[model samples]
Structures are given as C-alpha cells and as structure tokens.
Target: MIKRLTKHGNSLALVIDRPVLDLLEIDDQTPLSVTTDGKCLIIAPAPDEKRRQSFQSALKKVNKRYGRALKKLAE
Candidate 1:
C-alpha cells in the first residue's frame, strides 16, 4: 500500500490504512521501531512492557541456574 508523505509541522508523516494497521496489530498509541535495510523499510511494534518483564525474569532464572559455570568462564 502506498501512502503519501504529508507535512506535519516540522516533520513528515504517512497515515497507514486501517486494515494495514489491524494486520500489523498497531493502534494510534502503539510504539514502533522503524529501520531501513538497503532499499527496504522495516516497521515493527515495540515489545509490550509485561512481555519484556517476563522475558527478563526468565533470563535471570537461567543465569542463576548457570551462575557457577559463568563464574568459572569469567575467571
């Protein structure tokens, strides 16, 4: 889908269509990461706070289980 870039004060913006927004599971207030790989553009929704916390907790658990190994490796 093509979207025109319009002026918004000092910045330009492209308004995504509703269907596309639904497919991307993004709402107006959703946080997103945008990047360009060569000529292609990438847009992805930022991880949810709760999900991020869960991942951190899981990582901590794994680190604790392997703490002795990690300490040996560090030495």
Candidate 2:
C-alpha cells in the first residue's frame, strides 16, 4: 500500500492506514524502531525491555530447576 507524506509542522509524516495497523497489531502510541539499510528504510515494533528482562529472569529460574535435564537433552 502506498501512503502520501504530509507536512506536520516542521516535520513530514505518513498516515498509517487502519487496516495495516490492525494487521501489525499496533496502536497509535506503539513504539517503533526505524533504520536504513543502504537506500531502504526498515520499520518495526520496538522491543519491550521490561518484558524482555522478565522473560530472561524466568528463563534463568527454569534453567536452574532443569539444568541437568536440559544438559542431558543437549547431548
């Protein structure tokens, strides 16, 4: 889908379509990570650092409880 860039005060903005936003499961306040690879621009949802830390902590606990089993499985 093509979207036109519009002027927003001193900056330009592209209005994201509702359907596209729904498909991406993003809201108006959703954080985004934008970067450029050569001439191509990439946009994606930013990782939730708090959620990530919680997940890492949970993984550590699980590993501690099942370390022997996991090590056996890896063999």
Q: Candidate 1 regions off by >4 Å?
A: 52-75
For TM-score, the strongest prediction is 2
CA RMSD of all predictions: 5.1, 1.8
lDDT of 1 by residue, 1-75 (tens): 567899999999888889989988899899998899999888889778999999999989989999889989999
Each model's number of backbone clashes?
Answer: 0, 0
- In candidate 2, stretches whose alpha carbon ends up further than 4 angstroms from where it belongs are none
TM-score per candidate: 0.60, 0.77
Best by lDDT: 2
Q: Candidate 1: which pairs clash?
A: none
- Per-residue lDDT of model 2, residues 1-75, tens digit only: 667899999999888888888999999799999999999778888999999999999999999999999999999
Candidate 2 local accuracy as lDDT?
A: 0.91
